[model samples]
Target: MPTYRAPRGTRDLLPTETPTWTRLERLAADLAARYGYRRIETPLFEQTDVFERGIGEVTDVVEKELFRLAPRTEESESWVLRPEPTAGIVRAYVQHGMRTWPQPVKVTQTGPMFRYDRPQAGRYRQFWQFDVEAIGDPGPAVDAEIIELGTRFYREAGLDGVEVLLNSIGDAACRPAYVAELTAYYEPHRVALPAIERGRLDRNVLRLLDSKDPAMAGLNANAPRMTERLCADCAEHFAAVRAHLDALGVGYRLEPGLVRGLDYYTRTAFEFYLVGREGQQQAIGGGGRYDGLVELLGGRPTPAIGFGIGLDRLILALTETAQAVPSEAGPTAVVVGADPDDTIARLRVVTQLRAAGVGSRAELGRRKLGKQLEAAARDGAHFAVILGDELADGNVGLRDLPAGTQKVVALADLAREIERAHAAHRHGGGPD
Candidate 1:
């Protein structure tokens, strides 16, 4: 027999790594809420059309990466693990009547998204994202705000090397002309086009600008730029977005070649990358304005802007750039030594400390008090509440591991004593 393993494109996040994920998730949720975005969760799988219709049938996620489900029995409509969150968020907005609540409803969600692609470094078949969206607002200020939100989030995570590469992709009002010019530029050299890119040249010309085929670099470079062809309104919107970002002191560079990966993006499209002094170009996250997506999913026409921060790639960059990925906070105290004969009374105090909002752990069995203290130290517990001698006198010995001091605390006042110990630590006296 062979050892079973995680399927291709997937890997386990073991206990040692999960605490970092928890810490990052808590920070992300807090940052999202501080920006006035409420958290919302949607089903992991949605009707396949939610993505196909929302992300467009010709896009890579729909054409190549979607994981469609097989029904247990016939007659159920098809479903797929979500390739992204925005479409499902839009569907939820329409289905739950959140439309009537308020204009520009801002929401955030964090979870796994599945895409069946051949994985590479920092790219997985299953990935997690922290998605933030603001619906029903058309202001360029909102677009800038979304960008600022993402920038500030990375800053909080202690990632100071990220730089924003930005561009305006125009919209239906002006994109048609740019696409026409783009098509004309390629039609003349159609015979020279790579077979994979030829079909999309007509239906999705903008995608050609994003082609990675080294052979087409020349053609893509010469293709008409979207910024030059933007309609009056689109150009003004892009300018305002730029102005607001400058006003906030968020540094960004204009990368006219950046078109982003989605079909719904318009006007403003940007990607955040870890820019090293040696020219590192690892992109951590990106998103853009999708002003037409709401109506496409059955809700009234609404304008929206959002970005999904890739949790996996961000951590990878953290490791690469040597940024700190915080771990879960350590336990406040641990009960040291074997349980007393009156087990219920001794253990009850530990439970009571926990119920009263303290991080507490207990040691079981006849481990020597020495070994028990070692376990408490390994557990990162600040205080070792030793169950010894004083139990008969309704007192326990409290040892401060970091400061190396001890005190006799009344068993009835265990929680308070733990608090006093920490307070002492804060005030410089410590356990001494």
Candidate 2:
């Protein structure tokens, strides 16, 4: 026999860990609904070109991190597990002709995403995210709305000192000139740059500004800021976004070099970072406007903005901040058989309690009454209904495990008796 464990980059969330995950998912879904965003689910995997075309072939996500699957036959299309949700979501929006339904269709989804990256403290090969997207709207107001949505999620999750870093990377009209100016600024430093940075300088100049290499930091810091080069329309859009944020009482800091990882993103890029932990790896969540993504995915040109909150990093943050992660409450009662042959009677009593709106379970086996009671207590059951010889007399024993007391009640009155005990306990009286 061989002992196997969860694969290198994944871990099983046992009974002890799942309640917190469920709570977070529900919180995200409920908050998104309140904002008028309907739920949308895309497949876990999609046609490879959906990402390659939307995220860009030059990007690391498509070039390196993608978990690409080979085609089953030469005529079959290739596929890959989604490394991010926006591209797939956009694919759905286009495929289903959502543009005809309504303008600026707001939608949200949460699920597992696969990325082939080095697994560290908060990063995982398989992780989960809550995504929100507002499509077919190019106005700055929706941009501000999505940003605030991310901030509110952090606040409601008990996180403190989260700061928003905002930037505008210019749209297609003005971005080429900015990229040209940026390429010129770094021309002299080309020899000093590393192989990867040098390649980025010539291929995707914007990415060099976001590089983590210490050697390129000095050159990147000296590079011209896109905010200074934004065309009139972009500058006005950026200002409007800021005004909306101020009006909503959401504060943010402007970052000149905040071009996000994706190629589809244009204008109004933003990220949520914890104060004193501003590393990219520490970013709680981030997204920006991708006005051209729908067209890139085969739909007519449509404007959209969205964000993804990495839930794995979020859970880690909750633990590190000492915020309480709530656990699932135990059953209200456990029904135990008082005799070896009383299994059927105990099942009936448990079912009756359930019908009366009691959360309950039954202890199976021919164990003695004392053992059964002990098992129920260990399971966090508040009370145990022991079906004894009293069943013939239309009565049974209700034992309060915490109080170490037992009382006899008519079988028909068992549910009412339990309800009253609960009411008494809630009112600060003993469950009698």
Candidate 3:
């Protein structure tokens, strides 16, 4: 016989960990609903081209991190586990004709996203994300709205002091000239740069600006900034986004080199980082305007913007800060079978109490009353219902675990008595 375990880069979320995951997902869904964003779910896998075309083949996600799958049949299209939701959601929008619904079709989704990258402290190959997208809108107001929504998510999640790093990468109209200037600046020092980064500079010069390579730091710091060369329209859009944030009282820093690692992103770009954790693996979520993605993905020229918060990273950050969702209340009452003959009576009481909205459970393993009560207390049960020979007289023992006190109550009044005790406890009356 051989033992098995979860594969590398993935871990099972056991019972002890799932409650927090559930709370976070619930919070994400609630916030999305409150923000008027409808939920949308795309397939777990999509045509490989959807990503290659949408995220750009030159980007790391496509070139190195995509978990590509083989064609199922000879005629089937190449497929891969979705690395991100935006591409798939946009694909759905195009395939389902969501454009006919309304302008700026806002939608949200939360699920697992796969990436074939090296796993780190907070990064995983198969991790969860809370994604939001506002399609068919080009105005800077929606841009600001998306950014504010991200901020609100963190604030409501009890994460304080998250700062916004904002920038403008300009659109196709003004970005080419800036890229040319940036290329010229870095061309002289090409020999000193790493081979991979040197190739990146030639292919996607903007990425080098946000590179983590310490050697390239000084060189990139002096590179031409797109914000300084933004076309009039882009500059105005950036300023408008800033004004919207200012009016909303959302503070931010202007990071000229903040070109998000996506080819489709244009105009405004932003990322949310813990105040002191900036410049580290502390960026929990970020996205920007993908004005060219729709057209690139076979849809008409539609402007859209969205962001994705890495749930795993977010949770890790929260844990590091000593913040967490409060532990949930456990079973309110446990129905213990004092003897084999009490099984039916115990089950009946458990069902009735549950139907009456009490979180009750029955010990069905034929354990002795003492053992059953011990298990109940370990499970955080507030009270224990002992079923024994008293059933003949329609009576039972209701033991308050926390208070270490037991009382006799009629069988029919067990549920009501439990409710009354709960109310009394809530009102500062000790367990009766």
Predicted structure with the largest lDDT when compared to the true one: 2
Clashing pairs in 1: none
Per-prediction TM-score to the true structure, in the order listed: 0.91, 0.94, 0.95
The residue pairs in collision within model 2 are none
RMSD of each: 2.8, 2.3, 2.2
Model 2: per-residue Cα lDDT over 1-432, one tens digit each: 459977778888888778778888999999999999999999999988999999999888888899888788999889999999999999999989999987889999999999888788788889999999999999799999899999999888888888899999999989999999988999987898899888988778988898888887777777889998999999999999999999999999998878788899999899988787755556888999999999988999998999999988888888787674664566888999768567888889999999999889998788888898888988877788988788899998999888889999899999999988866775885432
Model 2: runs farther than 4 Å from truth?
213-217, 278-280, 427-432
Question: Is 2 or 3 the stronger prediction by lDDT?
Answer: 2
TM-score of 2: 0.94
Candidate ranking under TM-score, highest first, comes to 3, 2, 1
User: How much RMSD separates candidate 1 from the native structure?
Assistant: 2.8
Tens digits of per-residue lDDT, candidate 1, 1-432, equal 659989888889987788678878999999999999999999999999999999988888899999889987788989999999999999999898887887889999999999999888788989999999998889799988999999998998877788998999998899888888888889988888889889878668887887878999887887789888899999999999999999999889998778777788888999998886333227788999998888888988888999999999888877776664544456889887445344565477689888877788877655677888888887778898888767789888889888679988888888887987676775874332
Ranking by lDDT: 2, 3, 1
Q: Scored by Cα lDDT, where does model 1 land?
A: 0.85
Q: lDDT of model 3 at residue 308?
A: 95
Q: Give all candidates' CA lDDT scores.
A: 0.85, 0.89, 0.88
Candidate with better TM-score, 2 vs 3: 3
